[model samples]
Target: MVWIIGFLVVALFVYFAMLGWRGFGLIATGEVAGIGLGVGVILLPIIGVWLVYSTLRAGIEHQQLARAIKDDGRELDISHLPIRPSGRLERDAADELFAQVKAEWEADPEDWRNTYRIARAYDYAGDRTRAREMMKRAVGQYHHVQGR
Candidate 1:
């Protein structure tokens, strides 16, 4: 999985480099197209920086959450989670497992940790939309908790 992630990062970098190269080529023409391409080239790095920042911030936040959970005497044991080799969960089993967590989440909808836990379940179940929605909620609640 680490190798896959590394490969993907390299691939994305190469892809973005190609795009920037093309943009630079267009900009060299010194035409109206140059202005547009120049804008694209500028925006690409800004977006890339934002992406990296967001990913790193999420990692930090997740680590914080794990620490908080541990301090609260809760153990997050995800080893039993039925993830397949395809990076998706076995849907039926995931659904069954998530049902319990869903109940927990429903009981305390305002708890960011619960929200994040449910989001993980949604991700394991391959429900990206719900996972993203839940994660947004979780992040919002976390920010609220932090008085941010």
Candidate 2:
């Protein structure tokens, strides 16, 4: 299901990119307006491509982590996790949740699952930088243990 959506998004981006490129070719090359349009035409596609690549990469990484967690046979209790209508956790709730998760992570710094949980807590807290850092750590540990 997600793959279908991803494919549709990529197709849309590609279609728009082709149109932008065609528009660039129709503009007079030497005109200032043409230069601006050309830049926009080039940049928009590049940004779109980057977006697609990053999103796919992140999804793949997350899926791999989920598989690892499942295979580990340990359950993570998220019943008390607070989420808002926007699909994000409330700041105060996230902070409290993060504190508990952080303690567990500190207790076993080498556990990839714990690290991943911490990353998720940070993510819920709207701290993407910390979340990414924790995810990197989690991935590294998983890879190391898996001999990958």
Candidate 3:
């Protein structure tokens, strides 16, 4: 009967109410659900802190690279983009800049673009083993994004 089914549903929800959720308590469609609100309370601050750290790290590395780039050394000509994405850096007038970029990227694996550049740097410097490792990390990240 409809009444029996309804009662069973309610009972089922009550049995599983302790899993960081209130079960079926907030069932409104098209509106922000209670579970969503609960998740937002926990996830937002963690993500915010992560983003802040990433931004600061990137800024610091950018400044260091810019200073290095201006000095006299073997260098690679790059575009005017203030923040260069990771790639294989060339041996031009700015090789020092490329070396700095490789160091920063090695210290932080979260920068996917820089990972590729660092790998290329090592590859060019005849460190094939390190280059392969960095390339593997980059490939792993790429696969993760694709899966998502």
TM-score for each candidate, following the candidate numbering: 0.67, 0.71, 0.34
List the candidate 2 regions with Cα displacement exceeding 4 Å: 26-28, 80-96, 124-129
Q: In model 1, what is the error at residue 122, expressed in angstroms?
A: 1.3
Over 4 Å off, model 3: 1-98
lDDT of each candidate versus the true structure: 0.78, 0.82, 0.55
Least accurate stretch of 10 residues (summed lDDT) in model 3? Answer: 19-28
Residue-level lDDT of model 2, residues 1-148, one tens digit each, is: 9889778987878787796776577465868888778777777777777887787777788889978777886545566767788987777888888898889999998999999989888887789999899888898898898899
What's the lDDT for candidate 1? 0.78
lDDT of candidate 3 over 48-118, digit per residue (tens): 55665665554455444434434634233445323324554444524565577677786876755566567
Model 3 has an lDDT value of: 0.55
Error of 2 at 127 (Å): 4.0
Task: Give the runs in model 1 whose Cα sits over 4 Å from its true position.
Answer: 1-30, 80-89
